[model samples]
Target: MSREEVKLPDLPVPTALDADEEAEKNLTTAPEVPVTPYTPSAVTPWSQDSGVATLTADTAPGTTVPVDDLPIAVGVPEGADPAAIDGDWKVDLAAPAASQDAGVSGMIMRVTPPADADPAAQVSIAVDTAGFADLYGTQAAARFGMVLLPNCVMDSPDSGDCAADGGTTTMSG
Candidate 1:
């Protein structure tokens, strides 16, 4: 006996959306969010009301100021009283002046070693803006001296690597 083969109808894939169905799916609705006005406050010194700086530690002898509450002094000459200075007090004006000295002609910043430090080994910070400008170009060197008392290292004494304590040297010119 021979068996007969039965054929089944192919079903359609459902991906296309009808306009009415699409409109309902993408319906516009206004969200009912509560509206409230935000009031802003001003930032003032530690003495100001509602200022963070106004809050201080209770157990201190004097006014225990917060880290952010400390005042800054700017524009005053070197060794000036910090309290007497005002207006963007943190700004530094005295940068190491550039030099053309035969040795390392650059901005020289003198740093006094601690009194207890080796008396013969004082350390002075020096920056060679010209050398930097020559090597790295002005774009990179322009802001080189902006940092206050920038740390610098020398390959040798001619580059001001020698001890800043003014030690005598036997090497002749």
Candidate 2:
């Protein structure tokens, strides 16, 4: 004997009103507060030194502080494109032999030891094309970027190639 084919029930289409129904129907009315007109004070203003003693009378007690807005550039070899960075870049602050530089755009990340770590064991973090690219994407390498060799990890999972001495780095972006 031939068996009859089973038919599935059709799902109902949502009505236009159902789709446009307002989920929140709160109708709160705030209590009205009578606002008084603001009037200027008729009394005279008090003197600055009336309550407090004058700290300086003969000379102004202030010193000018110089701020250097000059950009601090990292030492990258001349004519070397920053986009070409695609390897493990190690930065040894003591020796300076592993010190290499490259250009960047969006952001730069580095890895460093924890605060409790020994001061003498501090190592410099490095950023490569893949690291930089992963950070700001490949487009960032095209533009001019600065290097920021952080003394510690940025606290991000996908930051640089790897953590310096297996430490984590945090990412701002």
Please, what are the lDDT tens digits per residue for candidate 1 over residues 1-173?
A: 33456666798888996567545566577988998864323222122111112211122222222223222111222343323222111111122222222133233333322234334421222222332343333344455452232233212333443435334343582
Q: C-alpha displacement of 131 in model 2, angstroms? A: 7.5
Tally clashing residue pairs in candidate 2.
9
Q: CA lDDT, every prediction?
A: 0.30, 0.31
Off by over 4 Å in 1: 1-98, 103-105, 117-137, 140-173
lDDT of 2 at 61: 21
TM-score leader? 1
TM-score of each: 0.18, 0.16
Candidate 2 lDDT score relative to the true structure:
0.31
Give the 10-residue window scoring lowest on summed lDDT in candidate 1. 43-52
Q: For candidate 2, what is the TM-score?
A: 0.16
> Model 2 segments beyond 4 Å from truth?
1-104, 108-112, 131-173
Provide the lDDT at 65 for model 2: 12
